[model samples]
Target: MRSVEEHQAVVDGLLPAMPAETVPLAEAHGRVLARDVVAQVPLPGFDNSAMDGYAGRWAELAAADGSPVRLPVAEDIPAGRTDVVPLAPGTVHRIMTGAPLPPGADVVVPVELTDAGTEVVEIRARPPIGSHLRAAGEDIAAGTMALSAGAPLAAAQLGLAAAVGVTELSVRSRPRVLILSTGSELVAPGRPLARGQIYESNSVLLAAAVEEAGGIPRRLHFVPDDVDQFLATVRAELAGADLLVTSGGVSAGAYEVVKDAFATLGTVEFGKVAMQPGGPQGAGTVDGVPVVTLPGNPVSAFVSFEVFVRPALRRALGHASPHRLRAPARLTSSLRSPAGRRQFLRGRYDAGEVSQVGGPGSHLVAHLARANCLVVVPEDVTELPAGAAVDVVLIEGALQ
Candidate 1:
């Protein structure tokens, strides 16, 4: 049996680095930047107000000592006003938030500090000079790097790009993954199941996983356990697919159509890894497209994807950190694992403590859904008592 690390390396090496493509800023969210994005113009391109108030010279307000100083409101300035004139020597301008500051105005007295008026206003208090003014180039300067290469674009980053007049961004292209699941006893959900047939769910699970990992997923209908038919179905859909992912049929069973069909081609290899719930694995090429075969059980398929395929896809997409965040957590209860295989148990992690969610069963999809983390038990250890510190791979909110 191959160790888990060996199989991980083999699977990760299957796909080459993806090339970059220019996409509209709207579509670039969740994609990794291929090149540094520079600011086309400085943030806050013009001096603007940070508050709704009156703009005037600080000297006029301070001349009143502790008494209220009244000034004529020369003009009312709202946001988006382009035809702004400098403030007269002794008059003030009524300004709203984000409105450009007039040339001679050096301070803003918040509306709350002055009598709210349109034609004339009374300033009750004096504020420091240059207060409540957003200076041009204060946030970021023009021609400087706004976002660096290898950064993942999100809402804030996209907003910044838009602020700097960036309409398009160069990002790593998402890999197109063709996904399928195999089994003779499998039937689609929402259909009545016969005595022996069960609902097929691996395809849905793996397809969502692929998309969550930043790969484009095209899910093929679940194929039956016939070697010739399986080979034909896969080869037909292999066009334009960068990677092929299938679940089931690679295990040691009599009618393992995936292993049987791919073995005949002499390109794909099948083996077992020293990991519980997802030991059976395969990786190779079919018609020049990379393929990764995972065990059919829903939990197993999900775990295998998290362990192997997710990182590989993220790496191809140029993500700097492709793996899940792992941290040490104290166990709330005892657990046992097989002697020679590493175990990844569904777990709930909170505040430095992790508790097992359910028994280590591959078919317990409900338990898997309730888990926010995976409690990893190494191969050398068989039993871990309560309060023992073990590593946990955090999953909740980790995709971002």
Candidate 2:
């Protein structure tokens, strides 16, 4: 009988943020940095024209009304060449895009405003001191922290790292995960299923979830409902993984192989939480390595990943803020939950409000597949009416 936040606290205690490893910029995507990434040098390095335009002092724009200010074209400054000196007095510089501004010039006139009067074009408008010119450090400054430790190494973050002279960065190492599924009536996918056997989909789903959360799922270890065999298989898989995650066999049935096997191994602590579908949860260390065992239902398994395992992995990999964003939306239909335990209802949401995509039962798989959101109905007094404001677990992209 714990609140959602309380269970979250228990899960959080299982993993702590750790330092990062140095990885090549290309491979560092989606990893968290170990430390702050600061700029080694200013971007743009110098004042350069933002456009292919003429360079001149502001005084030239006012003088354009008079007889053409046909000044001598002092130095031709093209893009990528820094050898040209500043504009000389009473002289103009033919500047191209990305070309540095001469030391003496404080303005730029685009190439379109020109005449065939002489080799030197007539000046028209006066560009301000910083107009069109990208001054040094305008984008980024030297020695400034661009990416902080525990922040995700996203595409934009990587680009910023490169701008700051970071060829490789110290990032969090992806945890090696071993996914094991237990059941007597489970058959692998793409095969002929028997009368009592169902396709084993939890391993595939769990593996993908592991990869998406930045962990490396070694492979699936499927164990039939034989207690001795399950125990033996789990030991063999644990030897190679940093952490182990298993689905099924933790429930209260006599055939619950997982619950019985771990009763003496000192690895799993079995308990039925005050929640639906996913109420059964267990976690502990087997031979010094961390392991979390989830309920068998497909919806329960996926929800367990979102609620418990994913955040744990993220925290272990050095994520500062690892929880999903709770987006508030109006419920389009009524919902009722068990009086005591909290519920995670699978749902689909559109622009403004949300409608239940699947039944509230944890056993419903078709509805779970169509859902992209989890409508969080708290343990408090229970009816969530249509158009009611409820907190929704948004599995969608970050709310930009």
Candidate 3:
């Protein structure tokens, strides 16, 4: 059996970095920057007022020590106003927030300091020189790097790009993943189930997981356990798919269609890993296209994706930190695991303590739904006492 790290490396090698593509700023969110975003124009672009106040010469305003300095309001300037004139001596310009400052104006006294008048305003106090003035290029200079390459574009990054006059961004493209689930006894959900048939759910689970990992997922209808039909269906749907992920039919069973079909072609390899809940795995190229076969159980497929496929997809999308966020938390109860096999148990983590959500059963889909993290039990340890420190991989809404 292979170690978990070995299988991870195998899956990682299957996908190459995606090429960069120019996308509109509206669609660039959550994508990694393929190139540095250089500012085409300086932030703010020109000198503007940071407050709604009167713009005047500080020397004239400061001459009144605690006395009311009265000045005639020459003009009204609101935000987005252009064609501003220079401030004439002995007068002030009533300027609104974000309005461009008139030339020769060095200070702004807030409207609250005066009587809030429009034509003839009263300046009650003297503001310091350059007060309430947002200087040009104060946030970012023109032609400078606003955001570096390999950065994930989030709300703040997108806002900064727009502020610097960027309408489009070059970002790593999302990988297109095709999901296939095969089982002869499987039936679709919401349909009547006959005897000896179970509702198929692996496709839905895998598709959602793929999308959460930043890959576009296309789920194919579940195929029967026949090897020929599976092969034909896969070949027909492999066009334009960056990665083909199939659930089930790869285990050591009598009618494992994936293993049986691929064995004849001698392209895909199947094996077991030294991990509980997701031991049966396969990763290889099918007709020069990448393939990853996962277990059919719902919990097993989800765990396998979180362990192996999610990180690989994120790395291919140019994310520097591709792995799920992990932290060490103290266990609230004792746990047991089989020797020589790594165990990932469903857990609920909160405030430095993690509690097991369910037993170590791969078929417990309800328990997996309630879990926010995976408590990892390493190999060579069969038992753990209460209050033990174990590593937990944060998932599902566990990120703080």
Q: Which candidate is the best by lDDT?
A: 1
Candidates sorted by TM-score, descending order?
2, 1, 3
Per residue, candidate 1 scores C-alpha lDDT tens digits across 52-94 of: 9999998888865699999999999999999999999999999
Give candidate 2's error at residue 136 in angstroms: 1.0
1-400: candidate 2 lDDT, tens digit per residue:
5555666667666655654678899999888888888889898788888887777777756667554466777778889885888677787788889888888777777776666223567764454555777888988788877888888989999998887788999988888899988888888788898799899888988998899888999766567567787778778778757788889888888888878888878756777667666888888777777778899999899888898899888888888887887788998888887788777888787776888876777778778777778888777747877899888887743222
Q: Which residue pairs clash in candidate 3?
A: none
**What value of lDDT does candidate 1 attain over all alpha carbons?**
0.92
Report each candidate's C-alpha RMSD, comma-separated, in the order given: 2.6, 2.7, 2.5
Better of 1 and 3 by TM-score: 1
lDDT tens digits, residue span 249-354, model 3: 8899898998898777888889999999999999998888899999988888999999999999999988878998998999999999999999999999999999
lDDT of 2: 0.79
Query: Clashes in model 2: which pairs?
Result: 20-171, 21-171, 54-109, 86-102, 86-103
lDDT of 1 at 397: 35
TM-score of each: 0.92, 0.92, 0.91
Q: Where does model 1 exceed 4 Å of error?
A: 63-65, 396-400
